[model samples]
Target: MTDPGMKCTRCRQPARFRLPAHNAHFCDPCLDLFFKRQVQKAIKDYAMLRPGQEVLVAVSGGKDSLALWLTLEELGYRTAGVHLCLEMGEFSEASLQSCRQMAARLGRPLHEASLGQLTDGLSMQEIVWATRRQFCSVCGTFKRHFLNRLCLELGFDTVATGHHLDDEAGRLLGNLIHNHLDYLQAMWPVLESGGDAATGFARKVKPLCRLEGAEIRAFAQVHELPVAQGKCAGSKGATLLYYQKAMDQLEADMPGTKHNFYLEFLRQKAAPPPPPQLGGRCQICGAPTMSELCGVCRMLAQARQWREKRRARLAAEEAAAPTP
Candidate 1:
């Protein structure tokens, strides 16, 4: 027996309010449909997909990725879901299972890559603890690296990611805060070929970029796509999580904050500037960068320096403390 109100997906309680678009009997289903449509439209308007091209989808077995996979298949794009099993603990097993179940249900080919194979003895936990960086970055880098490599190796022409509007907006805001204008420019509908590992040789696009997170959540609920609930173990204290939380809080207080900010971002018009010149490859990675060293290598170098400084501080503190 169901209550009169729409039901929540995470919790089986009746939804607080009616979502009109999906004609949701429950809030979750309504949100799911809304997100799917938004993703479908974004793909079409941005020309993100080609009819015959095989899309190498990076599935985390979560709502966002699952929604993307199903929607792309529904829209007639031939897709194969590829999952990277980071093996972060019990969560890794669950994530892998979710990925397999979803792929089997959707009847699409699913490929899996393991971090253990790629890391050359560096586990995800080792990288996070050693680098003093969140596992999200390492996991993201490895995932993107593996995804693109898999695509190129398998002859896939493009890669599709489930980065929605909220993710994009939060990223843009994060860039603004950090003054990383180059990355801001790189976040376009069709990214120009460059240093990005994901697009080194194959094109990559985000069909779900225009949709909101809530909408994606709703779409998944309506379609009843099998998605696992829980945060990535490596994501517990990630910087992106903090930024996302801040953005979510702001959006909650000021509804549509992310949506409106991005709409205005799209509508932005600026005075014409000089024509752009071409770029050369970085000496280290052969990837295009404004400087001789690519941004990624440059950042890693800075991180190493920061790590050294932090170690020295910790050592000094330990020396200064009286023996117990």
Candidate 2:
């Protein structure tokens, strides 16, 4: 017994459906084949996963992360869920709870760390306020650094993130706008030699980079995976949104616009500049860096400087304003 017609996830056309493993309803013939091929292609094209290797999945309780963890498990890779609680009030609690429930439902093990534990008594808000950097950079840096370090400490050979095709395209285009060839080349599916003091041999992989965020949303809907539909509580500003909207407009004008961008870039014989030559690991922490202090610390100091200048400017403006 099957529905004769179902909405296609990709093209959004009414079409027949077939059940994908893990209880997902995918459109028959075209979309089904497309999805399967996408998954296989990503795996083969990037060498995302290796046989019998353990993967630490950075789960955010979102469609993409959940889909990735489930897919890896279904594909027989040993997956350990890694979640970070940013301690952003209620939002953080809800995210952590949702992740825990999903892990329980799937009978998968999950590892978690809190921002409070990692930073020196610094909340994400404080970090942003002090560093004068935008919200995304502060949070992103802490999360990525913590995740990699945790993976190394835990002895996992590879770290998997839930960056989808749309995200990848966005980064590529952003880099292209600024001509950041080194960063662009780092967009490969697999990132080997993800250096960290704890796990000197940690590599990072992105298996879902070929799948669109929309596809992951569709998969979540088909499987009824629990997820948050709202934006992150800690999210603010407009740089990322502006870029995403611009790219979205391109996709609207031309179907598969994002995919084509990546495909075309891959066809180019472009490799990033050789890895940076490091003098020595930071005496405080053993992570890759050039100066005595790493980028994270430098960024944090810059954020603080920005905040001080902003405060002074505001105070000067207030003092100069005529009395009402």
Candidate 3:
């Protein structure tokens, strides 16, 4: 049922993969080259990286992040990895291992920061319990704060993320569905990082923004990258997953739909005007936030209070227990 005689679009070699979105077929060598070229083009078009600048890549051990890291390294950039250990049991351990292996293979230093250690001994589970928010919401806040903090403290010139075309399209679709115009406007291939420092915020860029999810996965498989195969346990039924499913179905129905939609958004959208009050740093954590306290600080405070109340309740229960 396969087309054995199909040829690659670039070369006359036998096709190894079919990319319906691009209406293209590529051999193994061509496919790998195409993947790298897309990332390089994105970086050049956006002016993401500079010569001799240190880039801190946020790696999660997944295909996208690993592929991004590998591609940047191959492109001869000064790249390092920062992985957050959320301690989600086996998945967390596997992710951390994969990240370490990736760093070792690339010969780059990998910094591991545990959530418990960073949050004053409060685990991700405790934060979720305390805040009563979605797991991803809490996790995302922590990652953003810590990633920016690390970039500032370590003197990284830029922070690169693993957001590809499919991720951007899904996020756009979700924002449209929720009428989040502000977020929609803020979405771009390159953004000024919201970190506070004397040298200004470290720019954030997405080198893989033009590639699709399937393409990245294929590249990772072809290159044999040590990518974690498991999904996050907390994101089992996340809203973003539903949005991604919808986007996938749409893309399957009409190839290039995702690319067109996201590109149009990037070209025509503008960030919403900020409120009259100027944004300032959080009193508690000293991060750049609009409010008096940053979201991470608020969550940590709630987590601490929750732990205290839980301890008191347990003590009261033990005291009230009858001798058996």
Candidate 4:
């Protein structure tokens, strides 16, 4: 049937891929079916997106997001793509090109925004340096802000992201280790639109939560999806990488480990006593916030201060350089 190899678990055709967690091998078609089924299961189980609710997919030009956009389109959902350009030099250019290529391939409209416009002419790296905040923290807040803004402007009520099983499993490990109950409560397959109308909050869902990162990469490869290659330069050595590596090692030792860890966590539905957090509009951007100032506002304020200092220092250095 397929390429003359081991029989596919479903159809006895030659298997092209093996899923140790499922204890099965599948041909190309079966693997495709499996991906769709898992996605469908997650969406239905969580009531993630309604039949006709417009979905604005957050595509980062990564394999996960590429797979998500393609899968949702294949599943017959009305969808569009939103990409945030962090202006990280070549990486940013490659990412935007990938998004455009995918959108062209799928014939879907792609919306683009830049870090400079989003953060008062500051890039993500600049924001991190200026605010002395973690890179991921700064990037996440800005991305959230942009996604919320796009969702409102485009009239998309549901915003879907590309978070998958491996990501969740690793995050679960960290949260469990740190005993961060508030973050635990917040990490759901579906996060409803928050804040009032002015907040530009849209319902966020993770349709790919059931698929593994490997599965997504493989799927993207098989389908020839145009996804940006290479990791962001900013995330060179993140703690989350260690957590993910630990989970990967555990999963290698025991199949289904990652899947079970994340799924069971969701199934248990344990809620800890909610942590005390501030709740008010960001005085600057007017987004919903746990604190008086939202993350973007805080970063913007610091970024401006840092920029001024940087300019002054550069001017001093240039002036002091004798005989250029």
Write the residue-wise lDDT of candidate 4 on 50-92 in tens digits. 7756789999998999899999999999889999899998888
Tell me the TM-score of each prediction against the true structure: 0.74, 0.81, 0.93, 0.93
- lDDT by residue for model 1 (240-314), tens: 766778888887777668867765675572221222233766676555446887544554555556667778999
Worst ten in a row by lDDT for model 2: 17-26
For candidate 2, the per-residue lDDT at 57 reads 90
Task: Evaluate model 1: give its TM-score.
Answer: 0.74
The collision pairs in model 3 are none
> By lDDT, is 1 or 4 better?
4
Shift of residue 92 alpha carbon in model 2, Å: 1.1
Over 1-324, each residue of candidate 3 has an lDDT whose tens digit, in order, gives 126778999998998788888999888899899999998888877678875567999999999999999989988888999998998988999999999999999999998888888899999889999999998888887887788777777778578999999888999999999999778667788876543453235667899989999999889878899988788888866778788899999999999999899877776754422222327878976776678988889989999999999999999999999989
- Of 2 and 4, the candidate ranking higher by TM-score: 4
Worst 10 residues of 4 by lDDT: 270-279
RMSD of 4: 2.7
Displacement of residue 19 (Cα, Å) in model 4 is 0.5
Regions of candidate 1 where Cα sits further than 4 Å from its true position: 1-33, 194-199, 269-324
Full ranking by lDDT: 3, 4, 2, 1
Tell me the spans in candidate 3 whose CA falls farther than 4 Å from its real position.
1-5, 194-200, 270-278
